[model samples]
Target: MMKIAVIGTGYVGLSTGVCLAEIGHHVTCIDIDINKINLLQLGNSPIYEPGMEQLLTKNIENGKLLFSTTHKEGLQGVEVIILAVGTPQGENGAADLTILQQAAKDIADYLHNNPIIVIKSTVPVGTNDSIKEMLEDHCKKEILIVSNPEFLRQGSAIYDTMNPDRIIIGSYKKEASEKIQKMYSPLNAPVLITSVRSAEMIKYASNAFLANKISYINFIANLCEQVGANVDEVSMGIGKDKRIGNAFLQAGIGYGGSCFPKDVKALLHTSLQFGLNASLLEETIAINDSQQELLVVKALQRFGSLNEKKVALLGLAFKPETDDMREAPSIKIAKQLTKMGAEVAAYDPAAIDNAKKILGDIISYTQSIKDAIKNADAIFIVTEWKEIKNIELSSVLKEAKLPIIFDGRNCLNKTKIMECDSIEYYSIGRPAIIKK
Candidate 1:
């Protein structure tokens, strides 16, 4: 088993460290936040990810995983260092490499020998090369920098990590790449050995393509609504073509997460830096931006105006099974409705605390969907939670003041919702239903 040190105990770091340990590797997760490290050391997960807490607790109990606040402690005698820190979007939409650079410097400062450094965070092109230079300047021995970008989704991070579709390792040294490959040999996934730049570009390109697919479907969903065609039917009909899969084809309030938004902007920034105009990415972002407003506009059309209207929001997190609210469309929708003088009441299974920080006193927080819809004029489905999708329309309409449902994620059943008296239903890429 490889001895690994994972810097930064955020989602990627914590998950990677624990999951690696579960696979029989010795892992040390380092974070500067003492409270976070303390919590993690006690087998407590700071983030709400499915199966993460159990895995962390199990690994810790088995002594396969450990947490520390000091990078020096974590990096000592570590054969492999995986940089999984945050690379948040900077002012100009480029990836701010501050955290990555600091991690590299720390690795350089504490290097006892030549260890293979792997970047598991999503970084822009050429970052691996810069990291190599930084490490070489600080270390007296040779250091191999490998680009091993992660492709794990938020909700299913552990499963995705263990059973990845492909593992791309970009490194100048074939031996370093092989060692990293052997570390993941149990995964049995296809390993792609390529140049560092290509591996870096792969992450951005993959996210951008997925974002584009969602935007394209949203565009088509809008057209379907206007032309009286059902988006669900269109999606299924088109998705059956084998080449076009049905993954991101669902019509919703656009795409939102840590990956899609930042990656798209960073790719655009990279293209501009390289003197290439990325019109496709620009349009992709444009469509996603408009989607949230489109939902708000539809609400306005139904209510004539949002002034004093109490709208109940079903979900706050970007997606179900994750507490990550970074760039969530729910926040944008809440702000837009509040700006228009609407009273918003929101509820989510796990993201309420985080949402409370961003939304402040602008939106009312409720403990349950029933509480959120109580005496509300309209109900807006923001995040597509399983509970939200299966909500009883009769119960919600009974409690609602106006009995209107605006589904941003198309969660409600059209026929069932239309059966209720004085109830109206609106959804993306579908005809609106006004009770006769």
Candidate 2:
């Protein structure tokens, strides 16, 4: 029954606020955007997360959750303030703490008494200590700074939050850590208490390592294609080992989203600041950059020349089930196709509107995947949606002009695609299928 104020209503903020309320805590979500606030006040979600809107609506009806644009109004009697603001990557690849700093200053100016301030944003190793100093200098009150970095994946944020594997709390004060841990005690998840700096490092270290895993498998997949080995088989064979485990090993159009790319870059920047170099991370980024170009090359090789060619892209979001396209490889591939004088028609189950904002006039929008692929010279499966994966290649090829498939996500049955006349199929880390 602790009162919590979650500042900033972006994906992390909104999800955290509503979920907390659902767990029986009285929650207030504060945001600067009046339009977003207005929408939330009506029990509507500005972002598309599975089950978030419904939970938010239920909580609002039950008087457990509220939304506002004013921080003072939300913070008046709140016991804990969670900073969930954006920490976008800056010019030098470090996390830009502009939003976080502003939120801290605002919280300082509005607080009537000392309240525990927890930073849930992914920040550098020592950011919590600095936040404490900044708040104390401004407010002249004892503000407990705790680092409780979020580990929610975009598409499965709700499930991940409710059933987290572990929760890490970083604080100098043992009592502050205990208080936060008590709030989450009902979940029955294991809680790790550690130094503030170690907790911050855990977030970046986890993301950077995942990014490396993806890049590692992608590189192996590329070599498999050249050596006539199946990447799927290779991935399975290696992933069976318990030590390696089987996640983030899928060969696709590279990793993209709000977290992995930015965090990896920020970690590299941190290393550079200490006069150290991260050669592995540097290569991971290089391999990912080259992997996208390889897909384009495979498509062009099959089609001869892309000039005046019509191409259909099946998925536009970075990954499936979320509308975030922060660093989607689809944009790069689509733009490359357009630059080669190919007319690109794209469709996604969600994220078309957001994609249109970034890639306006460069690609045509289609109502459905079938419509997008109609009369197209080539088709690229960029995102691995379950619906897209389940599509019958026999039916889709009948509608396509050239029947050429470049599977960035390896979402097609190679044998079935090759069975069709005039069909050519190419996929990552696998043998290309060319029909005579």
Candidate 3:
């Protein structure tokens, strides 16, 4: 089994390290945050992900996983160092590589055994070359850098890591590429080897394309709403075509998460940096920014004003099963509702604590879906958590004073809403069921 060191114990690093250990590799995960590392040492995951903590505990018990706050201990005798640090979006719409660069410097100082460096973080094209140059200069030796971008989704990260659709390994040396390929041999997935620049481009290109599909479907959903055509049917009809596959076709308020928004903007920034006009990418971001406020616009159009109205927000996370609130649509929706003089009681199965950090005391937090919808004039289904999606219409109708529901994610069952004639139901790309 390969001995691996993974820097930055965020969602990607922690999940990757845990999964690698699960596959029988001895992994040490390093983070700068002592508190985070302390918690992880005790077999507790700092972040929320399904099946992550269990694997973490199991691996710790089996002597496969390790956690540390310093690079010196973590990088010792490691065969591979996986860089999974954050590349947050900067004020100029470019990815800020400050953390990644810092990690590289730390690794350079502490690394032994000439371990191969694998970059699993999303970066702009040519970033791997820059990182390689930086590391070689610091170490005064030729260092192997592999562009191995991660494609794991947030909520399902554990599963995605273990069962990836494909693995892309980009490197300058065949030895480095083959070693990295053999490391993932346990996964038995298809591996594509290319140049460092091409592998870097693949990550941004993939995220941008998925973001484009979400925005495109959102545009269609808007058109469908105007013409009374069901977007669900339209998505299914087009998805049946093998070429068009239906992955991101679900019409919703928009796509929001750590990856899509940052990667799309980063790609647009890169395109413009090269003196290329990327109008489609620009529009993709624009559409998503607008779509996040659609439910508010709908509420405004229906009520004319939101003065002192009590609105229940069904979910606060960007999507389901994770507590990541970065660029979450709920942030925009909550701000808009509060600015319009509405009282919002928000609920999410997992993200309430993280949401409170971003949202503050502006909106109330509820423990249950029932608590969120109590005595509300309107309810907005934001994240579509299983609890929110399976919420009894009878409970909403009984608890809510007006029984008005706006489904931002289109998670509610329309047939059930139709059966309950007293509740008003509105969803993305679907006909509103309003009772007189």
Backbone clashes under 3 angstroms, per model: 0, 0, 0
Candidates in order, TM-scores: namely 0.98, 0.97, 0.99
Q: Which prediction has more favorable lDDT, 1 or 3?
A: 3
Error of 2 at 149 (Å): 0.5
- For model 2, the stretches where C-alpha displacement exceeds 4 angstroms are 414-422
Q: What is the lDDT of residue 170 in candidate 1?
A: 97
Number of the predicted model whose lDDT against the real structure is largest: 3
The positional error of residue 124 in candidate 3, measured at the CA in angstroms, is 1.1
lDDT of 3 at 349: 88
Query: Comparing 2 and 3 by lDDT, which wins?
Result: 3
Candidate 1: residue 301 Cα off by (Å) = 1.1
Taking the tens digit of each residue's C-alpha lDDT, what string does model 2 give over 1-436?
8999999999889888988898999999998999999999998888888998889889999999999888778998888899999999999889999999999888888777667899999999889989999888887777788999999999888888888989999999988999999888878999999999999999999999999999999999989988999999999999999999889888977998999989999999999889897898899888888776776788777768899998999999999999888889988998899999999999899999999989998999998888999999888999988888877777676788887788899887666676677677789988877775
- Taking all chains together, the TM-score of candidate 3 against the true structure is 0.99
326 Cα displacement, candidate 1 (Å): 1.1
Off by over 4 Å in 1: 418-422
Model number with the top TM-score: 3
- Tens digit of lDDT per residue, candidate 1, span 1-436? 9899999888788888988898999999998899999999888899998899899989999999999988778888898999999999999999999999988887678777677899999999999998888777777557888999988889998888888899999999999999999988877899999999999999999999999999999999999988999999999998988999989899988988899999999999999998997999999999999997777999877768999999998999999999888999999999999999999999999999999888888899999999999999989999888999989988876798988888999987766776777777888998778884
